[model samples]
Target: MKSALKISGYCLIRKNRVVLDGRVLFETGPMDFSSFAAEAYLHFNTCYPKFHKMDNLSKLGFLASDILIRDKKITESFKGREIAIMLMNSSSSLDTDKTYQQTITDRNNYFPSPAVFVYTLPNVVIGEICIRHKIYGEGNFFITEKFDAILLDHIVNHLFNDGLALCCIAGWTEVNGENYESALFLIEESSGTGSGIANFGPAETESIYQGI
Candidate 1:
């Protein structure tokens, strides 16, 4: 089993804007998809300045990790630390898939853009996180009707017990056309709070998806 993990910090992005920085966590809001994407791009660009403009999921993932590291103070100290991602999305990258389909529909005169294909899967975000942080740990993504606290709590606990990762960046990053909102948390073992993962009963669960 992996050693017990603690949630030292957290960061959140909402409607593509930096609603929550470092220790802040914001509730979801009603926002268009394009606006959210643009906001994500903007906040990421501002936070990562040098590397945020890269037009790739991998770069975005790295930027996200960088934010967490800088905010949570988990830096070179966690160079080889096992980290996992449990990212959830509503559409399963339907937006990118639509673009990809458009490319294929006109194969006679169309060639798939590598950029669109790269982000056709929700887990692409996780891959980006892993690559940027050097996390050689277990990673998974799910398409849920909406966020569910029960499933998240159970899975996160399993990861800790199984030694998959010391901590996890578990949340939803859904972008469809021009509507998007995200509410994520940094879940880890902690004796300081409730019961850590186990204590995430109904109350805590409800807390995660506050604006749902």
Candidate 2:
């Protein structure tokens, strides 16, 4: 048996509220995705100016990541290359795609700005997190019809078994229009730490994502 895997920490974001380790850290009334995201940015004191420039999808993912990875200082415990990130979503940046399309639908009003153009891809959120935390390990983003906790379980295990990663951040993040949901978990081996919050496996992971 390759030592136990543990779910050290996790964060969930939904309906303009952010939850960390089962506690609601921030919650707000009805608001647009941009307004909620900006409010979250300020509330958390992220201090990253680039956050304001990111599209809705990136902002959502970045916020969840910052709460789990940066705020918790998970990356500080492992080497950059020893950490990995795996994220899955349903919309796959469609929210930003729609916005991009709006800027070019009119022949005369079409505008191509790199600022908005760069966030067209879903993995950009992964890029932003990696850049912020200096995580150089393997990172992969997948698009599924819905959250597939089993698939994520297998991938995370494979990375650890093959020595591709010592610690990992994996979960589901999806943003469509004003709706968004994310549940990111920080997984680590059980040698040094006491069992963590719980073991990292399909059942545990799926349960958390399901409940979230």
Candidate 3:
């Protein structure tokens, strides 16, 4: 069996605050979801124009992954298809679903935007991340009552053990109205350089997330 995986990096976003590797990168007062995400993008100096066009769900995933892999040193070492992404959330795009519902609620002014309609599925966030990073690896999005660290750990390990991916981005991202939270971790083989958390499993993941 392969050695236990390690957490190379992680980012957490919640309550108008952003934390990376246990350090606060940005914080703000009450703001809408769009403004909150936009502030984070700007704080990181991210220049991706597509960010503005994405729904709240995609934007949350994109920002969390972008921050976690900003340096690119870790991800660049592997092929595009060698990196996977797994994400879960409780809301499952309900935030966008509500917005989309508003457009069609009035029959006389019914106008459902194709742009908004496309993001109804939660997995679209994964596609956005893949598009930005050019990752062609396996990816999936799940909806659960709450974060399930054990399932995430098992699936991530399965991908690595099966040679489906050399590394993975796994975590939870949920956005509902003005409330949003995300915790993303980059999992890969242990390099034994002491550059990351040496032990990565359900317990460790849950601990890190709770602490965040």
Candidate 4:
């Protein structure tokens, strides 16, 4: 039987708040990005201590994925290798890159921390999510001027057709200074479970993204 793609779950985070599948999970008054992220981490009960040490980009991805996968039960049913991740953002870790650059900009006070420097790459956020969820499948990160749901849908469909993954965590995650947003979806082959929304094509994906 041919596999039918479906959207099993989704999460959106923005403006110091998190919403999972149309339900508000966490919300806080005005606060810095770092503080807001920390509050979300604590509210989600994520015991990952390293979350505090990660750069803003990684923290955003980690927190968003943590809520989506855990609340949606993606990891419990799908093996680590069966799941893939494809994330995109406009900033492309420029937030962390600028921070890292500041450290070395002053030669006399130069003190580049490996922890901060390591997250300079946008793909590092994918690595952090994979490590947290033990997902060893294929993953990619793209930098685009804005969210491209059609491009994301095509890439994820290719992964499924090529037998590279059975499920995918795909979406846009962007963080720059006080501005941050993420809209992640869990796409999987329909097994007649009757629990997921059917027809996960480019238009459908774009609609969902736009609705968020």
Candidate 5:
């Protein structure tokens, strides 16, 4: 059994910037979320074409997870059932829901779009990440009023303690239209089999996120 849960890597997407493990990799100077996401996607050279069609929420989580999965190369060390993803946010897909509501709100123009309808749930972001990375371990999306580091810490530990997961992609992802912020961390064992994998918990996670 692993002795401790460690944070392998972290990525924060906020203020039109992308910070991966304390380094600024990409920044869209003074642009809106839509434009910033497009530029960041292209800048990172991510080949996921479906990225163009994702709602703002999915886009935020995708690009942030992309840094850890593609940039930090976590998938190279952990894959399939060994990797899990757990995330929480306050908005709970309300941003996309508002847009979907518009499709059916007006009597004359009540035309619902299946494409827009698909992203009405907050879990869509997790599904997008899981499908893209092929991670089959426990994936959960929680709705919280604020950043609950204690809650995130407990859930992640439970996955590891119960031997249900080896590595977990965890954090907070909240998106409300043009206003969005996400902090994702890759959690692993502190003194386990991996090298250069830094050491875990709510305080550490909170500090890493707060610094960004």
Candidate 6:
């Protein structure tokens, strides 16, 4: 059985769509998180992920890390903040896997691109997020046949209480060729707002995904 999670802010995104349904107001991407970043800056109280294609693990890590900061005013908000990233997917960087194989197979592969090679693993996203955000905290990756909201909720709840991440960017970044869907949330502990958990109930997951 998964333990309960504590979440404050919940921001969801899907297919370049940024859904602001909670206290935090932000954006995600239009092939990049630039617009999302811009919105966050304006709001001064939200979190958004970084933008990068390939829908790979590293990118997901980078995305989550970008949002876990406390003091948006601080030069280094991620500093001293623990981050627990819970990710879901189907292919699990299979795109990178095939690409790497192609790179190695080419006899004339003069430049063995280490950059591409690094994103082959599922956990690379976790590593990238931690490194970029300077988050020295707990991280976990889950590769399932499809998106499971229950699993995400369970993991996030535990991490919050354990003090792993003051907030989390948890969701599914599934890539299928050029067509992909990303439903992510910036989950955090409460600060004077109502318990975000109350937002949960039957069809709650779908509602969050819908951004309504």
Q: What is the TM-score of each predicted model, taking all chains together?
A: 0.72, 0.95, 0.95, 0.95, 0.95, 0.66
- Model 5 spans with C-alpha error above 4 angstroms: 193-198
Model 2: per-residue lDDT, tens digit, 86-176?
Answer: 9999989898888888888899987876787788899999999899889999999999999897898889989999999999999998999
Writing each residue's lDDT as its tens digit, candidate 5 over 32-139 gives: 899999999889898899999999999999999988888667778876889889999998999999999999999999899999999999999999998898888898
Model 2 per-residue lDDT at 10? 90
Clashing pairs in 6: 5-157, 8-188, 57-125
- Give candidate 2's error at residue 197 in angstroms: 1.5
lDDT (Cα, tens digit) per residue for candidate 1, span 43-121: 5443445344332333334444556655555444444456677777677778778878898887587887887787787
Candidate 4 TM-score, true structure as reference? 0.95
2 versus 6: better lDDT goes to: 2
Number of backbone-clashing residue pairs for each candidate, in the order shown: 7, 0, 0, 0, 0, 3
Query: What is candidate 6's TM-score against the reference?
Result: 0.66
Candidate with more favorable, higher lDDT: 1 or 5: 5
User: Model 6 misses residue 27 by how many Å?
Assistant: 9.4
Taken over the whole model, the C-alpha lDDT of each candidate is 0.59, 0.87, 0.88, 0.87, 0.88, 0.56
Tens-digit lDDT track of model 6 for 1-212: 43333344444444544344453444455554434434543454323343343234454334433543342311143443555667888888887787777777868875566777877777777666565556666767788988787787677777766666665667776655554556666665545245765443225665666555
Top-down lDDT ranking: 5, 3, 2, 4, 1, 6
lDDT for residue 68 in candidate 6, whole number 0-100: 35
